[model samples]
Target: MEEKEPAPGGLALIEALVNTLDVESGTDALDTEENRTRFGLTPADTPGARELREALRATLLAHAGHHPATGPRPPELGRLLTAAPLTITIAPDGGATLAPSPTAPGAPALTARVAAAITEALLAGVWHRLKCCEAETCHWAYYDRSPASRGRWCSMSVCGARAKMRTYRARTRPA
Candidate 1:
C-alpha cells in the first residue's frame, strides 16, 4: 500500500472535524463526552457544533466531486460561519497561526480556527486538493497527492476498488 499523504495544515482541521462521524462503522464520536474529548470537541447540549461539522464535511465532499451527495451548504452553516470569525497572527520569524477571534467562545472558537485555516488554504490554491472519499461507506477525508489533483478516494485498494467492483457487478448483472 502506498503511504497516504497527510492533509495540509490548513485542511487538517476540517479533516479532524469530518472524521468524528465514522460512516463505515455508522458510529458517531460526538455522541459521548469521552469520544468528543478524544477529538478535542466539547459536548455541547445543542447540536449546533455537530451541524456545523457536518456542513463542513458536506462542503469538502462537494469539492471532491460529490455534488450530488451534497447539494447545497446548509443555511445554518452559512450563518454560523458568518457569526464566528477567526484571527490569524504572523510571527516576526514569518511563521503563521490560525486562531479564533479573542471574543469567540468555545465550540465556535474551534470552528472559527478551522474556518480560518480553510480560508488560508483556499487563498493559497491548495484547499481544492483536500477531498472526502467518494464511497459513501468510507467517506474518509484525504489529501489528493496526484500530480493532476484527480484523486477521489482515501485509497485505491479499499474504497476505490470497492466502488469499481460495485459498478462492474451492476453493469454485468443479468438483465
Candidate 2:
C-alpha cells in the first residue's frame, strides 16, 4: 500500500516476508514461482511459507497496536520460532550472533532464516519497529522510523490520510 525504506539488517527479511501477500488485492507473491524463488521456497514449501507469513503479519500488526479483524487465527509466532534450528557463531571480533543451522533446503531453511532474523532484531532492539499498517485492507509491513516509534500507518498519504478522513467525516456527520 505504501513504499518506504526497507527495515535495517535482518529485519528486512522479516519485513519482506510479511509483505509477500498484498491483502487488499488478495495477490500473494508466494503464489508465483519467481516470488517463491526469491524467498528460497520450492512449490512444496508454499503452504508452510503462507502459514509463516500470516503469523508474521499478525505479530507485525500487534507491534503497531492493532489486531487483525478477520481470517482464521494464525499459529503463535513464538511457537514456530522456537522450532527453528539456530546456532551461535563467534565473529572475528568475538561478537556472537545467532544464525540458522545448516539444514535441508525449502521451508525448514526459510523458517531457520526467519528465526535468526528475529533473534538478530531482538538483540538490536529494533524488532518492534517492524510493523504492519493499521489499515485492515492494506496491512503492508513497514519500518517505523518515527523518533517516538508511534507510527501507525505505512504511509501518511495513503492509509493514514484515509483513516483520518473517515474519523473526520464520522465526527461531522449530521445528527
Candidate 3:
C-alpha cells in the first residue's frame, strides 16, 4: 500500500491492491501512471479503476463488520462482471484449472485480473478473513489469522494497544 513490495500470494494480492488506496484521503495509486508503475500496474491505468478498487475493499471490510469512516458504501453491483471471463477447464483426472481469457486488454484487463484473484479467494472461503487495519493513518492490509476470526487490529502490540490507551485516557482524564 505504501508503494512497497507487493505482499505475498492469495488474499495478499487483494490486500496489496486495497492498501494502495489511502483510507482517509481517498488517494489512490491506481489513478496515476507513475504510481501505477510503482505498484506494478500497467501504464494503461483506467478511469474509475480506483472506484472499483474501493468498491472491492469496502465489500471486504463490510464482510468483517467494519464500515469505512468516510466515503459512500459501494452499491451491490455483484461480481466484477468483465467481458473477459476466466477460462475453466476440467482436468482429465477430475481436477479443474481456471485461466483468464485473452479478450480484454490494458486497464480493463488489469481490472479483470484483480477481479479474478478476488473470485478465486472468495471460492476458497478465505476472502472474509482479510481486512484493513482500523487505524485511520495506519490502514495496513493483513490476514485475520485469529482463531475466532474476530481480530480487528493489524497488531495488538501496536494499533490495538494504542487504541486501548486512547480509550483509557479519554475515560480517565479530568473534565
Q: What is the C-alpha RMSD of each candidate to the true structure, in Å?
A: 3.4, 1.4, 3.4
TM-score of 2: 0.95
lDDT of 1 at 171: 100
Better of 1 and 3 by lDDT: 1
lDDT of each: 0.74, 0.89, 0.66
- Maximum-TM-score candidate: 2
Q: Which tens-of-lDDT digit does each residue in 1-175 have in candidate 1?
A: 2356568886876776777778878787779887666545556622766777777777667778885254554534466687666776899999987677888666777668777877788778998888888887777778888999888888999889988999999999999
What tens-digit string does per-residue lDDT give for candidate 3 at 29-119?
Answer: 6767776764445654545456566666667666667776665666442545454356777999998766666775555555666667767
Each candidate structure's TM-score, on Cα atoms with residue i matched to residue i, is: 0.80, 0.95, 0.76
Q: Better model by TM-score, 1 or 3?
A: 1
**Worst 10-residue stretch by lDDT in candidate 2?**
97-106
- Of 1 and 2, the candidate ahead on TM-score is 2
Backbone clash tally (model 2): 0
Model 2 deviation from native, Cα RMSD in Å: 1.4
Give Cα distance to truth, residue 60, candidate 3, Å: 2.2
- Which regions of candidate 3 fall more than 4 Å away from where they truly are? 1-8, 24-27, 31-35, 38-44, 75-79, 82-84
